[model samples]
Target: MSLEIRKIVSFEEETLIEGYKKADRPLRMFAVAAVVTNPWAGRFVHDLKPVVREYGPQLGELLTQRICELAGGAENIEAFGKAAVVGLNGEVEHASALIHTLHFGNFYREAVEAKSFLSFTNTRGPANAPISVPMMDKNDGGKRSHYLTLQFNIGDAPAADEIVVVLGGATGGRPHHRIGDRYQELQELGHDVDNPAAV
Candidate 1:
């Protein structure tokens, strides 16, 4: 399957504080987005497995490289996530098929050296529908303070048969992270550090 990329977009945001809490340095976020033709649009395909398997890695690698570049390199990225929005003519599955695969996700994970799975959002929507990509600490998923979300939209994109794909990255977690880490919570709950269950 060939991906006909119509356009590529990048977004960057800076925050000096959140809710009266100020940080020593500004927090920065980066996201790279792609708008492309949906090969399976306007139809129902029961067997999407092969298509996803083949295309996931290709798109993943391409998007990952762009995001890493925008974030100033993979080494500087601390939190990461991905998202997809399918045009009005496509099914939600068409959006999900791109980002949910390991073939696609692992490139970003390995690049950032993050152990946690990439947080994500997938949906069907029209142009300029606020797209959001949720991020988490690359090395530790349970870090409350490291949780973040990057949101943006393209005024003229995803034209009913297209899809918008995004990859987001942060140089660091939230400033003044006082919420505490998840490993501490696990220890407090008397769960084994190696393998803990949700409480």
Candidate 2:
């Protein structure tokens, strides 16, 4: 499939803490989302649940790698935070299936264990998911597309200080922006880049 990635969406440092507070967790957490396009999503015009189920682990691995890179590696993630996978538009069902699959669930557990991060939580939003839609169609041709957003919280990693990594993208294709690049942009916007002490 010819996948196209649009952009990676992340929460600002100030907002990261806000999200952690919203989670009612004692430790700080960073929330990040990845928006990507599934080039084959609309082409098939059928439920892609099977493909998602089979590839969920791969997708999770990619997400974990991206998060690690953004956090400066596994050591930078706090030991008590949550991560989420949010989907939009045509991705609702497929994204949900991916996270709910057996292999994908195991991958998440392994990631947390290996990284020494706190707990991991997986969630999904449908066509009108709560999180902002990070990708848009330039053509606006009513051509339905699938987008995946990955969000995570950085609890108390020294390297994270006050930074949370947010990355998201459309699946089936490369993203318009890299997670690291987006983080830098957020920093330039004067987002609270200092790591906050655990709540």
Best by TM-score: 1
lDDT of 1 by residue, 146-195 (tens): 79999889998778999998899888888887878878888999987778
lDDT of 2 by residue, 1-199 (tens): 4323344444432222332244232222234444445433333347656565655655556666665555555554432233333443233443444445545445534544432222333344443234322322222212222122233332221111111112232212122323443335446776644432222
TM-score, one value per model: 0.91, 0.40
Weakest 10 consecutive residues of candidate 2 by summed lDDT: 156-165
* Full-model lDDT for every candidate: 0.88, 0.37
Off by over 4 Å in 2: 12-28, 38-49, 75-91, 114-129, 132-199
How many clashes show up in model 1? 0
